[model samples]
Target: MPSTTGSATAPLRVDARPELTGDRRIAVLLSHGFTGSPASMRPWGEHLAELGYGVRAPLLPGHGTTWQDLNRHTWAQWTATIREVFEELSATHDAVVVGGLSMGGAQVLRLAADVGDRVAGVMVVNPAVSTLRRDVRLLPVLKHVVPSFPAIGNDIKKAGMDESGYQRTPLKAVHSMMRAWPQLIADLPQVTAPLVYFRSATDNVVDDSSEPIILGRVSSTDVTRVPLPESYHVATLDNDAPTIFARSAEFVARVTG
Candidate 1:
């Protein structure tokens, strides 16, 4: 598998035709994590697509390729890529719901803040935001000294997937995620849409600080938080993934109803 670095190189495109939008059904844009591909969210996307919603699980910039490609891009480029997909989805559907797994979660939160009124709701699964802990702070420094550390949870799911395996985990890419965390945390207060937060109780990567940050910032009284009992960092593909997908479908249904 190759790493995507947001360069001028052509992307590994997945064509999701707007087959259900003729009846003016809702649209949902599903975003993947930092080092992950659209395969992470395709099951959930297909679930929603089957429920009369148009779905698009776009491959984020610098992903579905090599880790070296990811190292070449920053958070800004990745967010812009998701944003462009959202804009296009919104143009064709009666309503739009934005959601993501991990970093894709941050992009949707920023999108909700930037265009809350335009979005119907948001659903985040094990979203990563703000890595201020001493351990994460030391990662940037360690990268300089250590040649390469295989990123934790960089493996892809073999079930219901249609893409290459996990690509490279670039040190520069991880550092960029750390840098973007603060801005995402700072901008959370501006979001006003209904939200569903799925947290993996045993997630090894993201800390628990995200719960308070999300609860304190969002203005929606209808926020729902569900704890995944058997999942790790990538809850969408973990042991309890079915639960996550069901909750996500319910969240979108509630908001769009």
Candidate 2:
């Protein structure tokens, strides 16, 4: 695991109170995808801060370094860091909305399920809970045999946008992420907070399967699904990112009110 829960490289954290919204002090804590650093979520977080909301995008354990480091860390290390960030935000802000990209999205959902109403809302872009790949079933046995494979990051439709994620997919870390999916899918009903889901219409990385599971299962009556017609997996750095930033701010205002 990385020495610090979140290193300072390209970190994004802004403390601001809205001059244009409700009386509640709200903050948005975002998490990056597996093998991804804070760079991916920084732009979105900055946009929220410009709108006068406290924003935080923390680097996960075993990220921002070599793929070998990621393999050494399990899903537990990543989840623990997210849990720590959420608790701190909840203590400081009147309300906190948790969100993320890819695996980061699942981490936030787990927190929402555990903490229930304490999480004001959720905003996920290209979140992955389960995969259609049959090879994944063999991860438990294959992870020891094979260390890693090609990365699933930077699947953007934009011309030159880069997610700056790991070049290799660490088997141990990825297997750990998928291992939590079954339980999370079952606990989806426990997440009752308002949800704003953004998914790229065509993604080479994540399929359309997880969307139905999340949209159908989460008990959030205020669920809103926004399809990114022109983007791919890393929608945060793609053409539709503005829409995500704008709508997410609105979501915060509505739920935190």
Tell me, what's the RMSD of every candidate?
A: 5.2, 3.6
- Top TM-score: which candidate number? 2
Q: How close is candidate 1 to the true structure, as a TM-score?
A: 0.84
TM-score list, all predictions? 0.84, 0.94
Clash tally, candidates in order: 8, 0
Candidate 1 runs further than 4 Å off: 1-23, 138-147, 154-168
- lDDT winner among the candidates? 2
Point out where model 2 deviates above 4 Å.
1-9, 18-23
